[model samples]
Target: MDSREMPEPVSGHWPKRSSDAADHHPHVDLRPDGVTVRLPTPEVDWPSECDVTLARQISQAARELDVPADPAALQHLNVAVDALVIPEVLPFWRALLGDRDKGPEDLIDPHGHGPSLWFQQTDARRTGRNRLHVDVSVPHDQAEARIAAALAAGGRLVTDQNAPTWWALADAEGKEARVATWLGRD
Candidate 1:
């Protein structure tokens, strides 16, 4: 089936394309909460035609089996490190993290088992705050709920200027995390 005809996810397990197109073979992780499905690398930022076809097949099979999905639980996590000069620090992280594949400003785990590492460029180094933070990317429809849940759990809203796309939040102790979504991304 084509992308236009692809079915919705059956059990919160919609297939997402890998960031790198060179890697083939879907990666399926069975977690206590649910399964996470990643389609073989796509040719572009989004899933390719073949990836969609495969997703449709997977969805169909899941439907046939009456599997349920919890879309709210779907999320992708990554670590972000602020760097004044990426090139100067990239190698250290690359070597320390093993042989992760490098993107323009990120290091991705080739095996898809670890959280991707993104390097954020900064003009000036800020004092008294951690240079690294965790970014949690959830489905667009679930971003608000997740943010609210974090707030309820003692996290404060650091910034919502990028709302609907991302919100910077901090724990009571000031450790930061970002709740993000695909919205506002092209």
Candidate 2:
């Protein structure tokens, strides 16, 4: 099964100390440690769709929590590891990250603070290529600008076959990464 359709993090926040979007309500959970913004999306099967404007709101909420005003500091990241034999390797990672299995192919930080780790299965072994890449899921609308920024930073496009949804990119060292959005997953 494609896990992309799994529900994203559910809406939640502390009482009297939260800000949320109304329609597809994004949640702003203001905790002592910091603020956790659970961006909302339509009921379709995708992770979550965030609004770029929400980032500013989250930053303001973070400041209220006594954190810095840096937007990058509030971003969430996840890692995707491509493997041919998941069962053989999944356990080692589950033990290493101390994360709980969200599904047969995914793990999440028990603390809600670490980037999610997911395993993508491959049909045949590919040689001389990195098996891991970063899956940076940002607000759906911010994808193109982010892609452009990477290009400006000397990262070259690997493939855009999945573009407007996800772009495959390679860094100066040829390491691969994907700038993913919630566009096509719907």
Alpha carbon lDDT of residue 160, candidate 2? 93
lDDT of 1: 0.71
Q: Residue by residue across 80-103, what tens digits does model 1's lDDT show?
A: 999999999998999999967657
Candidate 2, residues 146-176: lDDT per residue as tens digits? Answer: 8898999999999999977888999998889
Best by lDDT: 1
Count of residue pairs whose backbone atoms collide, per candidate? 3, 0
User: TM-scores for all candidates?
Assistant: 0.74, 0.67
